[model samples]
Target: MDKPTGSTVSPQEALIYAMVTLSAVDRQMTDRELRKIGDVVNTLPIFGGFDTDRLVAVAEACATITREEDGLHAVLATIATSLPKKLHETAYALAVEVAAADLHVEQEELRFLELLRDVLDVDSLTAAAIERGARARYRTL
Candidate 1:
């Protein structure tokens, strides 16, 4: 939802939206993908202590974001630009986790993520670390 204030959405909310949108990209949402999203939610400190209701709200927000053609990058861009420099890695990590949720990093997803990483100004090393962690989590290790 775009508010008049134009204040950025919370990073956790943006991340949840990103994951849900990624899962819906193939026009299907599998249990595997849902579980992966849940795992990402649970593991990320930004989403710590999020309740079911909050998760659902975030999912709805994601649906709204997805409906927009700009997609996850727009949400990521908002958060990246609004938050402080110190939080960039946390945002980048969330982007990577969401991009990997479907167990297959589609080209569109990779492109969006790379755009976000660059916009967030995440360094190459941290982006690599995020990708490595995602690969490990998806059992591609």
Candidate 2:
């Protein structure tokens, strides 16, 4: 799952990596979470030009990076560098969606999301709105 030397990913791929990293942070990636990631990729206009075939590789690269010491920070740095400021909230929203996909946000996921929010520089109000929207979307009667 090692990122190849000097390899870089597109902004869309970086967003996908963020989602995949959150899904796997709890050491379990549920079917619902996986499906949610796929749905986002398939539906988001930001990802419209991305090649689906690269998903596995992007995910693996994220996993590899997260396994290193301070890897989470490294991944966040990569994400920040790849995405424009305007899309920071979008990235945080995607992470929230993936975290809520399994109908439960584990402690690890919560912490990860908090760190992501901080790293992405998403303001509290916006983060709250994004999180609230995801919760509402996944609520069960």
Candidate 3:
């Protein structure tokens, strides 16, 4: 679905693609993960001016791409190209948050994070810090 991540893909759509890709990587979109996606859209400053009504449609578009051949790569490419350099870290953070939401980060999720880090050119230190923050935020009592 490279076409889905085409030139017209907005930054918001790119971000959603990142989160959806991670949440679907394990082939199980847990309630916590799904809720995290919704929360991120509703609360984050980055998502300011975004249309809540389009949330489901954007998410479905991304989810569809993830099931296609090299869909993950397609999504990542769209994200890297569409988002400004300032948002690379933000995109990674969003993905990490969703991965941690279920409090059981699967191996597939970890691999996707690693790949995303590289694709986004996120420094290892920054990536580790964001990941740690997500773990703290989602940790069980």
Candidate 4:
């Protein structure tokens, strides 16, 4: 991933990139994680219809977001208010994938997920369920 050069980018794109890159922060961007990211990126209606071009743009934007911001929470907050509830499951699922990618979820990763859930306004129960799913995935791996 490289820094994006676009003069302007959408908040949604930034959030997606933030989430994806953070998932890989533990130094393992697993096939499962990548697939999950791709599914979330393409299947979600956030971009109306995410394409190669959009994916590339979002990837670039995500790189920039990581470099420019301290961490994921700031990026999440930027678009959290407008994010659709339907996608919380996708977001949670993605977070789980990220956490499980390295076979271990760091406290920082957990914190980031917690912040993400908060920012997205996802209920605690849903957040807990997602965390459990991530933990389950790790255990099976």
Best by lDDT: 3
The TM-scores, one per candidate, come to 0.72, 0.91, 0.92, 0.65
The alpha-carbon root-mean-square deviation between model 3 and the true structure, to one decimal in Å, is 3.1
Clashing pairs in 2: none
Alpha-carbon lDDT, every model: 0.67, 0.85, 0.86, 0.60
Q: For candidate 3, give the lDDT of residue 110.
A: 94
Q: Give residue 30's lDDT in candidate 3 (0 to 100).
A: 97
TM-score of 2: 0.91
RMSD of each: 4.3, 4.3, 3.1, 6.1
Model 4 steric clash pairs: none
TM-score between candidate 3 and the true structure:
0.92
| Model 3 stretches with alpha carbons more than 4 Å out | 1-8
Write down the RMSD of candidate 1 (Cα, Å): 4.3
Superposed by TM-score, candidate 3 places the C-alpha of residue 37 at a distance from the truth, in angstroms, of 0.6
Residue-by-residue lDDT tens digits, candidate 1, 1-141 = 221122377656656655676566656766867787787777767667677557777787667766777655556555654566787777667657766665777776677676667766788988898889888877754
Q: For residues 37-78, what per-residue lDDT tens digits would candidate 3 score against the true structure?
A: 999999998999999899989989887777789887877777
For residues 1-141, what per-residue lDDT tens digits would candidate 2 score against the true structure?
232123346889889978998999899999999999999998989999888888888889898988999787778778877787888899999999999888999999999888878877788999999989988989999
Candidate 2 Cα deviation (angstroms), residue 73: 1.3
Ranking by TM-score: 3, 2, 1, 4
